[model samples]
Target: MKKLTTALSLVAVMAISTQAATLEERVKALEEQNTVLTEEVLASQSAGFTLVDSEKTFNGMGPAASKVYFSDNPLSIGGYGEMFYANPDNGDDFADVYRFITYFGYKFNDWVVLNAEIEFEHGANADKGGEVVVEFLYLDFLLSNEFSLRAGHVLVPMGLINLRHEPTLFNTVQRPEIERQLIPSTWHENGVLAYGRFDDLGIEYTAGIVNALNVNNSKTTTPKTGWIRSGRLGSSKNASFEPAFVGRVDYTGVNGLIMGASAYYGEGSNLKNDDANDVDGLTTAMFDIHARYENGPLAAYGLYTQTTLDGAEKLSSNAAEKASGYYGNISYDLGGLLGVEYKMPVFAQYENYNPVEKTVDGQNEDAFETETVTIGFNFFPTKQTVIKVDYEMNDVNSQETNTLSVGLGFIF
Candidate 1:
């Protein structure tokens, strides 16, 4: 009986020891879990605080990328560049190109802003004379949502792309001759302008005054007329800073569509001419229409411009004859092929230009006419970078020559 009792006591002690050991293990596990939970809570709180502060600070800056100063108020800087390659069917070779621009903008307040852009062409190489040009320098004053005033060097807003066309913004490798000759793309001079929109009526308008055109750049197709015509029309002369009239009217409510009509009338002067008074004043005018529809990865666009020169008979004997030119282009984009994430934009464009109007003294003068068509594809691996390939066809009216070109271009 004594042996049995001793055995029972030993079993009881073992059972109690096992129970205590299990309790200790559970407490240790619970403590470890609590430590992990505490750490997670601390981390989450820290992140939340950081996000709130960041939001507040961002909001306080008031949509500014740069600071304000006394002379220059709120300023912002942005620009882009492109490189290209070309192989012309006419045997002319163009390879590895570069064009760059930098723009600086200052906003005085909600109503006024100043913008300037400096451009560099052909890689800024000394071999190309390193053409450094000011593309635009202007001040804009917003009087109301429906009306604004602008002045200084201003773009002649005749063609669709003349004012807004940038390498990255355009789908093709080059602009059409029609635009170059008819409306003179990238043309700007000293001028003042007014523009605005009426949201209730869905109408927008732009108008401006600028310097006039010169005889050398006039685009008259006929040759028999004198070269000394009064193509110098628009605003005033260089010495006087003549002002030309330019403006446009637009409609913008058709679901992602922008359609507009534009016009320009101006006069110009010749400072270097010995017989300045004899040179006829240019009576110049242009008319154009453009439209764009874009949504997501798809886009469509078209533009046409026609220009005429009058008052040539009023000029002296040494001037040019009556001259005129017109241009048109159309394009579309097809987004992503092969079910890939990348955006594949394919487009085609046409351009024509007649630079010189009539020759001098019976000599076969330059009746410069150029026509070009381009089909290209742009691959956007990312939002900020584009790789482009294009095939271009050129038909020179004077030379009766044709060329084929292929090139690569990019922007960032």
Candidate 2:
């Protein structure tokens, strides 16, 4: 009977031990769940996102990642830069590695924006003499989708590329000649611009005073090669005016296209030391029209610009002479022609221009005309990076020249 009692005692002890083990496991699991919940709470608090107990859904993060964030108002940041190598193949052997352009910009509230573009030709050093320019420093006020005002350094909106020529944004190695010569690509001066979008008519008008022409013969004169030096300065005849009025108009959102016209007219900005010499004064006007079509993977664009000058004493004196120039450019894109997708974007583009038309002082020889044609393909591994290969033929009214360019262009 004593042995039976001891056996019952052992059985009771086993039951109590099993129950204790099960209770300990349940407590451990509850503790682990609490730890996980604490960790999740901490993470959510630090990350600035709400912690939800339900399923997760994908959110729109594309714009945020791209630096194009949307708040009560939309804002975007974008810019591009390029480095290039050129072989003229003319036996003259001219090669340059340069920083094309760098731009930083901000857009605020739909009606106000800021943009600054800096250019480094060889490198960012003073001896190389790179230029620091304010491409556009202005405030834009939008009364409505149809009416707005822009004041500051306004671009001379006369060509197709001038308004949208980010290095990675364009397919060609360089801008077309017509845009470079006739319309003066990258042309901007101090002024206020008025623009609006009305239904199918996208209209733009600008009138502002700007530094007048520099007719200083000593400053603008160059050698007999007809390469008219750099076009950064104005004529000497109207040095005193220092400013002139400019304007433009554009039509957009029409059936499959966009078109525009522009005009610039102003008195000379320079002053003459000798009034009797008769500084005939200077006046310039540019007219242009453009059209483009883009849908899906295909795109095409074309434009023509003509520039004219009048009022000069003669080709030699601080007097302006009658000179005119014109150019045209067109480009078309063919979607990945070989099924290469991002590896290949075939394109064909052509440009021709006669930038300088005045005769050499005393020599009575006219400036040579410049024309360029480019055919190439682009490889875009991503939206921000591109590899370009192009063959260009640059012809002058006096000679023939060509260049082959292949390079990588990107933005970060």
Candidate 3:
């Protein structure tokens, strides 16, 4: 809600600083702030939203999203940016500011908190066709580690990228296409969320009810045409009373490793299970499981997701029966293994997906099936910043294309 780039400029100084004393001073201030935050959070426990040392995120949420939960200071400002140069064999070469994002958090005492994300894409120029979007705005009422509540436009805990899309967290210059077209990263809706963790068993969970997707909009045939991404309400159209439920669970018993599975279920559009309406059991269901292992010099991760639409074929001309995709990556830190001065890891990723895996027979459709292989390396001048370069080979719906790119990403 606040255009605070200028304000961010003041805080940005700390990220770009090279002086040791400045870093030390910042750390000391951060520690003092934490001490105060803990005390206030504890004192406010009478309202049912306090936990000692609550600063730690039991669930795998991004650093920015979790900032307000335990901040002694009322406001927390941080951001990340990615700028890149891309050269495609089949297209022109260009350089662009791919993403500029800012995270703003405010703690209105311990029981209530506000978190938001403002995103600027492609340089944020109207002439150049750039745009800005309020990616997320949510409020959390912390009850305890075992139970808490969140409302407003909240992110769906469905895919890895949806929560941890910070560039440095992934290997390639771009996120996996499957996560984009299939799961639709950055997916959020008007809803309330319930999340908590059973720390004794290393189990974390979240359940929520949100506005259901508008798959049957008459103006756009996205639903009748079997397009999934366009169905997201996104706070644009009047959110239909039809609601969806999401549930997720994560197991983090092993140190430096996490495994999770989640599901989404809802009525497809406004279609009901009424035979008189000629649409029965037209429900949409999605399931996914993912795992990540990052310990020592080796890293490995993978995700598999699939969706099914019951009675969809009878409701839409281009409805799909099933859609699925999966991706995996493995990397090892050769620099560390070789005792090099800097840390660099060579990584490779493979993705296979079909946006419309199985559509209604006899209906015309674009499968949007694709496979990709990417090889890249990341160099860290500091723990918070990374320089990345990679080559991607795309098997686009059976066609071949190649691209090479280099970029920088930093978090503070």
- C-alpha lDDT values of all predictions: 0.58, 0.54, 0.77
Candidate 3 overall lDDT versus native: 0.77
- Candidate 1 vs 3: which has more TM-score: 3
Alpha-carbon shift of residue 128 in model 3 (angstroms)? 3.7
TM-score of every prediction relative to native = 0.69, 0.68, 0.80
In the range 146-230, model 2's lDDT, one tens digit per residue, is 6667665555455566666555556777766566545555665556666655665545444455554444344233322212223
How do the residues 249-317 of candidate 3 rate in per-residue lDDT, one tens digit apiece?
999899988899989998766533533643446777888999999888899988999987777666656
Q: Tell me how far candidate 1 lies from the true structure as C-alpha RMSD in angstroms.
A: 14.9
Q: Rank the candidates by TM-score, best first.
A: 3, 1, 2
- Give the number of the best model, judged by lDDT: 3
lDDT of 1 by residue, 134-219 (tens): 76677878688777787877666666666654554566666555555456666666778777778777788877677766543333
- lDDT at position 171, candidate 3: 82
The reply for model 2, stretches above 4 Å from the true place, is 1-77, 92-97, 100-102, 106-110, 200-208, 215-241, 271-280, 295-298, 314-336, 358-367
* Residue 249 alpha-carbon offset, candidate 3, angstroms: 0.2
